[model samples]
Target: MTAGHCSDSGPFNSDGSVSFFHLPWGGIVGRRLIGPMARPDMSVADMGFISKRNPDIGVIPSIRNTDDQEFPELIIYGTLDSDTVGSTVCKSGYTTHVTCGEILAFGVTVTFLNGMEFNGLIKATHMSCGGDSGAPVFQFAEDILPGIFITGMVTGGSEEQGVCVIEPIAKLITDDIYVLTINDPI
Candidate 1:
């Protein structure tokens, strides 16, 4: 996928139906949404750009078949857990594109209809404000090209501590990683 920095500084739209600003790493190239999210109501308009400093947009499947069942790309984000106390995590959102903080120790495990369970942790602080639900998360890596593996979804952040919980990507999908196909892109 191609990407570029925000040319216009006004109202933003991330819905696939609408063309929004996506400044790729270092604002070198720009990309328009050629596909929609797995959920019809979701859109790239919901998420914003990845900062040049952070320099990663989660993960985009390197290869896959058209008939395969997987998401070509995945984004996940959430707030810090209140009980967590250690290394910090990063997040991108509409309000604040990049925010980082420690993870809280307390959280709840949610089970999906497929019997997949996600052990979500409350972030120690609010990395996201309003308009951040559905944001994406990435596991940071220094050498990897993508440098991140799309992990889960950001549900919400609390007002007091800014703790947000995440739904692990494994729990959301049937496969370990999304398989993408060039013949018929999703």
Candidate 2:
């Protein structure tokens, strides 16, 4: 998934556009964007879909740790209830890589420089950066699975200390869209 703010930036350059990159065997494979789901203000729903995928490449359903080399085999089997708050959340992104922090508050409002404001966000300690806007947020537990997907992306926050503002996954689901689990077939 990608940030709504990033998706709102374009309709592509006629030739379409390279959306994501996959690095395997030290080589890069670029994926293209099929479409995006952006809110008018680009605050709550910040995600996009990639249209391209290489059959030869393996897609792991896991979040990579900061080390960038390890896949903990994490599976998002479930999500925390909405009223649940003040738990620890972790995320992996392009800029800061991987980091974990505590949830400081919920149902908060964050405003961007573009004059777009997002409400009902999860506020947490620092664990993200500028380029990490579309990173997934999860909760790590002692269970066999490494983590549980809790939110969609790291929408905003301080990159210096790692404070993060997240777009909760619950808020993203609708009558037509929902989160899928590993048990679901690809």
CA lDDT of each candidate?
A: 0.41, 0.65
Q: Which stretches of candidate 2 lie over 4 Å from their true place?
A: 8-11, 15-44, 52-60, 66-71, 82-85, 160-162
Clashes of each: 34, 4
Give model 1's TM-score versus the native structure: 0.43
Best by lDDT: 2
How does candidate 1 score on lDDT?
A: 0.41
Residues forming the 10-long window of minimal summed lDDT in candidate 2: 32-41
Clashes of 2: 4
lDDT per residue for candidate 1 within 92-154, as digits (tens), equals 554555555666554465343334344543344566644555555444443543234444456
Worst 10 residues of 1 by lDDT: 1-10
Candidate 2: what lDDT? Answer: 0.65
